[model samples]
Target: MGKIVGSAIVSHHPGLMQCEDFRRMMGAGQDSDLIAGYERLRHKIEAVKPDVVVIFDSHWFTTGYHLVDGGAHYEGVYTSDEMPWYLYGVPYNYRGHPAFALDIEAVSKEMGGYNRAIAHSGLERQYATLNLIKHLRFELSDTPVVSASSCQNCRPEHFLQSGAVIGEAIRRSDLNVVLLASGALSHRFVDIDWKPNHPRIFHESNLSSPENLASDKKAIALMQDGRHDRILEDWDSDFRKAHWEAFGAHYLQMLGAMGGAECRAKGEPLSAYENARGTGNIHVWFDA
Candidate 1:
């Protein structure tokens, strides 16, 4: 049986990687606390020493079926199309595990999650995985990695089932695996015209509104109390706004892969941030 040593939900905004440049662009205070939280996660990762790190990216939208990054050599120069000004010409080099990509595809097919392969050069990984890799010490050659796509037409149920298949694939393999759910909690944004030194934005960011804060707090509490089922049940409609990122599918994958019923929140906050647009960033660790 395969072993799962670590699992977490993280924010992969390009701003996280280019905090200084982002601050220069947005004219916001330095986010020292948010940096500390991610640093803590980095420490935990080193302790885990996983053989493979599987990333579930929110920005990677596949239409018909789930997709996996199947390229064995992941070396590329990344320039974010969304925010090229902040993250331009960033070099990312890593090793990929193509064999396990096929393994996950087979297991996903068995679990009714048809999987596709994205095996080629010139395809840039989304910031969700790239930002985290930039901060953490896990390199491609040191520890091979793979990425899973978030199907645009999928529901929370579909994501959960796909996550189960991924977990099963990890179990049948000999590698020690760690999982990452990379996305934002509340992803709504305001107008992009906000200049530097805006009063509404700061280190300890206030949530967009009280309702957004409450919704995010409740979501985190549910995770802390080991209420994975409630997340699966109320996510699509409740505990979230219509604009929340990935429809909370990122958390569903983390919850499902770690151990569906057995997964529980450790009441430990990994990282939390509210961007200028009122998007809530959360990083939580789930016990397998």
Candidate 2:
């Protein structure tokens, strides 16, 4: 039988792909360490030996229902429509486990999840999904992937319900699954002319502020302590102040899918606190 062998929440910044060149020009080498850290996480993922990856893409904001990518295989030269200058000419090709994705879709509807099928490979790939593939070196392996969209209209309760349904699907399947929640912690973007001297730009809702960083720390602390219920409760007010991506919905899904599996999770901080267009970019892996 299939099971959720592992799960993770990661930042999928577009700059990650071109960090070497981008950071070198700005006289900063922090990105090299960041890249290596992700390399280490990739090794950890390999150790799990997952057969398929179910990615929750924060950028794939579906309007009506939760859209699941159903393509048998995905292949294309990806250029980020949101930030083409950074991600242009990026090539990605990955096989898709359509059968597994279809099962997820069916199971979702059975549990009252507003799940819909999206089977086209040509649809623009979001950075959150593509960047994870890039950083994890997923293309190097043949493990198929399916992407789940973030429902724009989903309430916290409904979204959490949806996550539970997905967990049930994974449990019933015969494929070993790894769940990836793809997004940043804070998401206020810089709206300024970026210069090499002031390489790090700040959003008006500044990310580097002591309060924001402290809140992020608290949030991470909760995750490390396996206090997912606390995150779910505090996300709307306290945690949301830090401007988590999708109001921390991606992380909620990651936690919810654990099925209340009580674990005193040990975590690894994979990336540094960098600025991705004024958003706070960091990767912390909480082992399931």
Candidate 3:
């Protein structure tokens, strides 16, 4: 039977794509911890030897239903329309696990969830998934990947339901898998004009507000303590109000697959919580 060997909440902020020298300049002469964190996270993943990595892409938003890329393979040069100049002409080539994706769709149908697997190769790619692949240095021939989209209209529960379906699907398949929640904590961006005053954009002081910073730290603490139950309980009342990226669906879904509020996987910090354009970002690994 297939099983999830590990999982992580990782930062995929565009700043990580910049050249090392450029990243150092932005980090006040130090490299973003996320850079080194990727290496650490990759080593952990290697230890588990997963055959496929499933990414819950916070940036690939769908409206009516949850979506998963089931394409056979993907090969292309990508340029982020959101920030073309910064992430232009990037080459990417990777295999996709179509059978496993279809299995997820099948399980979703059985569970009365709204999830679909799109096998068309033309499906657009998002940085949330691509960035991790690049930073983790996954050899294209070794491990295939599948990208799942977050439904924009769904609440925290919906994401959890979708994740449950994915977990069932994984159990029915034969491929060992790793789950990645590719997004940030507090996602409120600073005003365009604010950069002039906050030149060191990556510094924690540049986070959108003190409240966002505190909220992110609180969530991090809960994760470290394996208190996902508390985080879920407060989703609507507090954490949601902090404006987590993609409504925090990436994390909700990943946790859902791991048994939702029942999961007690402790998080190991791979990167220090930091700021990216006023949003909170970090990398934390959870052994499943």
Sort every candidate by lDDT, greatest first. Answer: 3, 1, 2
Task: Give per-residue CA lDDT, model 3, range 128-232, as digits (tens).
Answer: 988988888765435899999999998889999999999999988887899999999999998887752356657788899898888899999999999999999
Residues 1-288, candidate 1, lDDT per residue (tens digit)?
777888888877666666565555453444534567778888787788888898888888889887889998877778888898878887888888999898988887677766666797877688878887877756733777788888889777677777888888888988888888888787766556644234535332444566776777777888788787776667657665635678767777766777675666564677655563567776777554
- Which wins on lDDT, candidate 2 or candidate 3? 3
- Which prediction has the highest lDDT against the true structure? 3
Per-residue accuracy of model 2 over 1-288 as CA lDDT, tens digit each: 778877777877666677566666542433435567678778878999999998889988888887878898888888877677777898889988778778878988788777677897468788888888877878998778888888878777766666777788888988788888888776765557644224333222345455666777777777667676676677778777777787666766666677643444555677555556656666677665
**Residue 32, model 1: Cα distance from true site in angstroms:** 4.0
Each model's total of backbone clashes: 2, 0, 0
* TM-score of candidate 3 on Cα atoms, chains taken together: 0.97
RMSD value for candidate 1: 2.5
Residue 54 in candidate 3, Cα distance off native in Å? 0.3
lDDT of each: 0.74, 0.73, 0.91
TM-score of every model versus the real structure: 0.90, 0.89, 0.97
Model 1 weakest 10-residue run by lDDT:
195-204
Name the better of 1 and 3 by TM-score. 3
